[model samples]
Target: MFVHFGLYAVAARHEWVMNREEIEAERYARYADVFDPDLFDAAALARTAKQAGARYVVLTAKHHEGFCLWDTATTDFSAAEALMAMCRELQPHMIVNDRLGIPGDLVTPEQYQPSRPLERDGVPVLWEACQTAPRDAALFAAIGEWMHRHRRAVHGAGPSAFTAPSGVTYTQRGDRLYACLFDWPFGLLHLPDLAGRVRFARLLHDGSELRMREIPQAQQAFNMNPAAPPPGTLTLTLPTRKPEVALPVIELLLWDSP
Candidate 1:
């Protein structure tokens, strides 16, 4: 929360009193005479700042009044220290932005999407992605609801984490992986990573089971014995060319071994 309270409050005009009025520093200092400490309640202001979703608050100190509200050696009342102490006592968890003459949290980056998730010391850090969507989130909720309602055999499937190629996304609930295909592939939707991990595959939109085959890429001349392919490069043969729905989602029951 930004509290722009200072000598400007009594000025009744603007915070830039000296600059706008062309008053000298010595003349502007006279505004401090009217500064009434009785009028300002720091604790009440801090409470209001918290209710406004402000994790932190910044106060306007040493404003156009030329009166040093805090950090003064002449008076016992160090307004800066007192105000901050009051804010800390009232809202202990509240962060104080730099405007209060304090060091703050890490520098925040906004309005951009990173190629990969941001991490510090190998730990993921909170980052923002700049993406525009319909202001009404109900559209997204409706789409998710439709997918959940038609989950069918793939409902409550899991392996927790699995890999799929680009343009595809998957969800795991119990023992099944529901792969939502955004674009229709040619003849086969090859899941190279799931070569040995998947036992069965089926179209979740319909209850039709799919046929799958595993082929090795590494082979020699007249290769009687083909070398075993690495994990996550296996291929599955899908029966249907395409599903009737606009976005086709398939369900695969994973296997433990090849």
Candidate 2:
């Protein structure tokens, strides 16, 4: 069974209310404030699926509008946090595609391997390359986050050469600088390139604010070596608990062009 439920249902027009009606994000987000799923019954739905001989169930936890169906620390615009917990208990291996929100390993490399072509009349068949190995839940979430938030920002500046720990990459879109952290940092993350440029910082997953501070030149040298970080290095204090997403993105609202 496949379920498609979201804030768009409140509009009563269609699932594509944001796109079809050309509704702005600010306007569309209002529906979440008033969203009430009074008739939702996860257990009953599971029972019905079982009676219908369904093997598995899938839920669209998040949609194109970025409304989450499950309770998330990342956002308050969720239908119900208990819904996800209930669904998990009912179906341990239940598949969830949060519409680029929380894609739970639906496609694996083994399942989406390259197809071998069969020859006919000694003519080799042309086969397209399978580009699925590198694609994971995190990549989808990143793509969705970019489209939902930073798509309108200019993208010609290319990647930033910011100094930071490994597994971190920076991309600039106008005044907004996105830090894609493949590996979650411990308690603090430092970016020397964004010394005095940052005006605000927040995690894209839940829109939670992060605290930042500038490291003075006096503290730049650890052992009086040339490899020390330069002065004016900005340090961001991250939350102890990481978000539920595969890849966490830090959206920095810059005071000047990055």
Candidate 3:
């Protein structure tokens, strides 16, 4: 399945953008925290999209610069290594908890207390593994053998021996609670690293009806509204097909206001 999600509005909510590229690029896919899970993880957001009936999640991992989604050692401006994000200390986990009301097993202060960083063959934390395996995450796993080495060591080591902070709240909205539809604008999206066809539907009457269709674009995802009006949602999933999926417009013409 494909989806047309809104990002500029979300960036606006975060006070991160004033225009098209500025909002979509710096605040999402290309943003430093876009995939931190603890900070900008897409799983929960994507899950919310999926619960709304999406099957593919096309995002702008990189903007016009040919940058990247995760930490790119190639340049210091990458979303993973952008010192600005770390300086801001944005709490993605907390945001997830707040927006989704995850009821996340209630982590105690002791759990949140800063712990010493771990090392791999004397190397510091690598943002590539993404708290999971890489082969499945080619986007984040672009760090080469060095990343693989550390990850192999960690995966082989198993869960943290130290008492870690509490995590995961099943009561999240992204799962299946309030499946609100998100409608993004074409001007608010861009992914230089993606390409393919998109399959999605138009939401109507409070999402009671879903009409399916296919859209072919070089990009990953897009919005239903070409310009602007009532906001809606475009549900989606991650890449698994041989090629990256495209962003097809999934327009909705209704609003919740009177």
Candidate 4:
């Protein structure tokens, strides 16, 4: 909670001048008369904070100078109430500190009164700890380790650069290939560019085997050019309807490398 006001307002310095300059309480109190924060509008501040994408804003009602910005029974000088009224009117969801003699939603208890863990019903994990930079190095390493443990079952070492049909992506390493289907295809699914020694093909998600047909490159009209490599395609027979699950992956075991 930091608001810039009081003697420092006229001094044009930080708000901690009374203590820094060793000014007497009586002499420092003189700024109260001149401390009219005419330009202070909490609604404008709230709007600025919202535009800046700030989750919350804290105002310094009282700095180390011991000046009260809000009208309190203890003092006659306080423009805080007006600013607070503007803030409440503009952003009702704004979080305010308790220093303004106002009740707050969060409580900052002293040591020995630690807060208990919060939970969300039905959801196993509710909270996420967001850390950055040097602190997240270990987190990145852990993710790599997790991926290493599941490497063999994955499509490839990296994602494919070539484009595929909607909801379809394939990974290839040498002769071994794997296909990931985010959406089920009705009837026969064709791969126009797959050219290699055909081998066993099956659905990876479940151990179910799928029948596949290969169009010989020499028989196709596109492979008629002698300079061009034989143009062939692999076709997979698919069910008309999708399975219960959302995405299904298929694995193709090739006998030889292309």
TM-score of each: 0.40, 0.39, 0.19, 0.34
**TM-score, cand. 2:** 0.39
Note the Cα lDDT for every prediction shown.
0.60, 0.65, 0.30, 0.57
- How would you encode candidate 3's per-residue C-alpha lDDT over 1-258 as one tens digit per residue? 122123332343422343434545444544434423345656755654444333334454543434454566765444433533453477543211111122221222221422444344685442211122222333332332322322222232222222211221111111111111222322222211111222322321213334322223333434643322122223233122211112122222322211
lDDT of 1 by residue, 1-258 (tens): 344666666666666766888878777666678877686778876655444333456676755345667867654546566877887899897655434454333323434645454566796554333233443435445544555545452333332356667777766756577787887776566675776677788777666877776665665426444344455565555654676665777777876522
Evaluated at residue 151, the lDDT of candidate 2 is 38
Distance (Å) between predicted and true CA of 5, model 3?
11
1 or 3, greater by TM-score: 1
Which 10-residue window in model 1 sums to the lowest lDDT? Answer: 128-137
Model 4 vs. true fold: TM: 0.34
Candidate 4 per-residue lDDT, tens place, 107-129, comes to 33322422232233543222222
Judge candidate 4 at residue 138 and give its lDDT. Answer: 46
Model 1 spans > 4 angstroms off: 1-121, 124-132, 135-145, 150-163, 170-175, 216-232, 239-241, 256-258
Relative to the unseen true structure, what is the C-alpha lDDT of residue 135 in candidate 2, on a scale of 0 to 100? 17
Using TM-score, rank the candidates from best to worst: 1, 2, 4, 3
Candidate 2 residue 30 Cα shift, in angstroms, is 57
Q: What's every prediction's RMSD, in angstroms?
A: 12.9, 20.6, 24.5, 19.6
